[model samples]
Target: MFRIPASNNGLYLGSVPQSAAAKNGGTLITLDHDMATLPAVGRTLTVAELAEHVDDMAGRLWAAGIRPSERVAVHMSPGFDIYVLATAVARIGAVPVMLSPALEGESVAALLERLDRPHLLTDGAKLDGPLADFPVADLTDRTVVATGSRPGAVSLDDLAGAPRQQPVLLHPDEPALMTHTSGTTGLPKLVVHSARTLRGRFRPQERLASLVRKRETVAIHVSYVHSRMYLALAVLLPRAMPLVIMNDSEPAGVAELFAETRPGFIETHPNSFMEWEELVDHPRRPLANVRYFSTTFDAIHPSTMDRLLRASERRAPLFFQIYGQSECGPLVGRGYTRKNAHKADGRCLGFAMPGVTNFRLVSRNGARPSRDTPGYIEVSTAGRALTYFGEGERFDQQVHGGWWRGGDVGYRSGYGCLHLLDREVDVIPTIHSTLEVEDTVLGRLEELTELVVVAGPDQEPVPVVCTRNDRPLEAERWRAAVADLTPMAEPVQMPLTELPRTATMKIKRIELSQRLRTQEGRAS
Candidate 1:
């Protein structure tokens, strides 16, 4: 048996460190400057006080019949309130089911059903406006816990007044958080992660001591509902002070927050950083105090990395290009330092981190593995998820002998770096018999900002390009560019304002294909 680490000394999901700023009387700032920052906003809560509040909230939830292992859905926007609610659920050894407020009603209802008897904690206004129309009650034995007053719901403020009690201790392998994927392919899968898995991914033993000693102030720009939430709670919370941004995530707002908070570390999606790049025009502020900047959840464009390196005033190391699916924690990451930053072949998604994780590439034809050959990426991790909520077939196909096939296709370079290609389903096959048309095209069109090559309605290849320049490309110029590749790519080029992206910023090829089909039908 793989022995799980003790929760006392090692970082555990849902438990904040006794040495945290919230405990040391350093305030937790919710960046909501538009509205008056509350007394709780700037005033620090000591670790003891924060624990007391969590205990009180947990006891009330328990009184209301919440039990350990029960899934409690938190449906609020980013804020301190979300932090409190999530921690409260964790205190009682229950799993917090996190969902973005932006998700459609149908998706929300489906997720609730999959989680089972989910206690919905949401904004009261949303419930009355759209959520109420859904079959929320039928999905689960859900009681509406509202942040603000609305009809047919209990106020979250009332729960705080309940008696305080010691929180239940959880085993390291116990499920702590349920984070859903973006569901771009189909229904979103509920990824259940244990305390140990969460820690392994976030608080690697190598960085644990430094984090604790420094007591760094960490800023998280992604939504708290993401898998990164567990990382924040398990790893960063135990070591650093957290700055939570409440308003919509705009690049300007994020830049302003960075200026105000001056955190030592920042964790966010690559797209967020990219969007922020547009807003930040002035010379980069000296982030001398900032120790690390981590990007995850989506592909980091090479151009974005270049811009960040150029814009950074303090010249801190570009920490990691994290790669992992929701089912598994961060499987791989690579640090890009100044010495190796400009090495030409773009950024490599580094090797595997220590702990019980292994990776292999399975070929499309089920052939044996070959070095430098592209194949479906599969990972075997000590922390692999148990099962999908309802999709047994998907669960079975992907999971084999403890290894999960990540549906993505990629190759390991001679330098041992992983270079991810497009998804297996998205691979465009042409009559020219070249399986690598997409890669060839992408390699040739490196100057283009964004490109998606897909099979058009007639099964002919089409290229959709989103350029930095607004002007449309001349047809002759586009044809001449791909002239070398003849009948293989009879490319129909279209200019798009911006590529439609999923929440994670992956190009939605299926949606793009549908749009192309609609256009083709109209033309016909």
Candidate 2:
């Protein structure tokens, strides 16, 4: 269904720069990772200049003996450089693999082994100890190309600096990038996607863009490894849309970023938004210019949606909470405004993205639910990844008749919107529905900052909560929050930042429970 050119670079880097410089070239991006220095110290590149950088980097990689389809891993700390080199790799018709910095060291090494020991392009620190345990044989043909010190590693800086060469265009079906799932549950799974698949997956950006006017600044704060790569290269770069990027989600840093860029549109992880919800009251009013807030990767907490939308100054601004998976792009999207965010409803994730996706709900006992019923969610999208890179059996198990089985548990609302309950693996057997209880608790307990209900060791319901304003958890308030509902274990209070989370910022219940167990053991 994708009619984009067969070029490995979806839109030529040269062409993108020309479009960017012509339309909106001045100060197109401000990348921030440090809170102390402010955005001024961060890299701010105009579109006119970034064009040269892309070409120069590609020429450097080519001169360094990189070739088309060579899988390369990017383990650099998140920054503007990751995007530059990633584009250069695709520009030269090579496949770039971005291993998440969130993956545990062994998980990172395990994924590397699965990729046939691809050339590693990263700063030396990650390779030093993370993969040290892997024998040289398993890491055979391994090469480390660094921008910093590494014994025997090639210096990217030492290569030729010419960028005038035109990028090579490969077949549309040629693989463009290989990435792994955010290892929230266990070891990450490798996923492969082709140029055509990437093009079709981000097709909705045009429509999503139409929601606001052109020439507006767009802000994005998600993993540099995720689908934002496509949005940055395919959608935003061409428009010369100004961007504000933050790898660090510390509220103070994000506040300063938006204070300067004053982003008109935002797309980030759901929990990241929750972490920044405190920015609503920052003196700068960082969200003042936000016309839309878009979230995906996981369902957002109700309180998070409530505060952020209310904070923005734009009249009738919208919140787009998308429910999707890493294996597939956006499946369903629901729009909420200040007026509707507080509307009494379960955790609704919205209807399918109309023509973009088809969803099915298969319930207990292996039957498709005839009505609104909680069950396993499955989706059919044009952009589903081709397969799990090396595990053919695992890939086969996830697909049936062109529909990929989603591991999430949810139901289709009577009006066609989808309401997610939780991950099937994260199911908590509460007397009341887990989502219902959580949403209700959030609505009643405005003082509660963050809440997650997980199954305790006895398969009983337990809650982990963060109180508003750093106040100690109040047993009376916790009891009152659940008084109208059902009796449950006392909430285990913890600092919000201490919660175990996936790369995308989804709470890792299994890991969090283990941490709590460890803390208890130490206390005893």
Model 2 C-alpha lDDT per residue in residues 141-226, reported as the tens digit of each score: 44545465456676776774544556666666667787778776788787887766676577655556666665678888888787
Clashing pairs in 1: 22-45, 23-46, 23-47, 27-44
Per-residue lDDT over 1-524 for candidate 1, one digit per residue giving the tens place of the 0 to 100 score: 22334545323444563345354434453454322112343534444555555566677777667777778888764455566667778877777888776667777888888776678877755576557688766776656564446555566556656766556556677677778776667667877777766655654423532533555566666666776665655554444356544445555556666666666666677756555545335433534345666776755655555555555555454555778777886777776654554442442576776664668777877665443346878887755665666666777898867678977777777777776765667665553312244334444553454555776776776777654354555566566667777353444455444565655556667778878889879998
Per-candidate TM-scores read: 0.82, 0.91
Each candidate: what lDDT? 0.62, 0.72
Per-candidate alpha-carbon RMSD to the true structure: 4.7, 3.5
TM-score of 1: 0.82
lDDT (Cα, 0-100) at 414 in candidate 1? 75
Off by over 4 Å in 2: 1-27, 33-42, 132-140, 160-165, 344-346, 366-373, 517-524
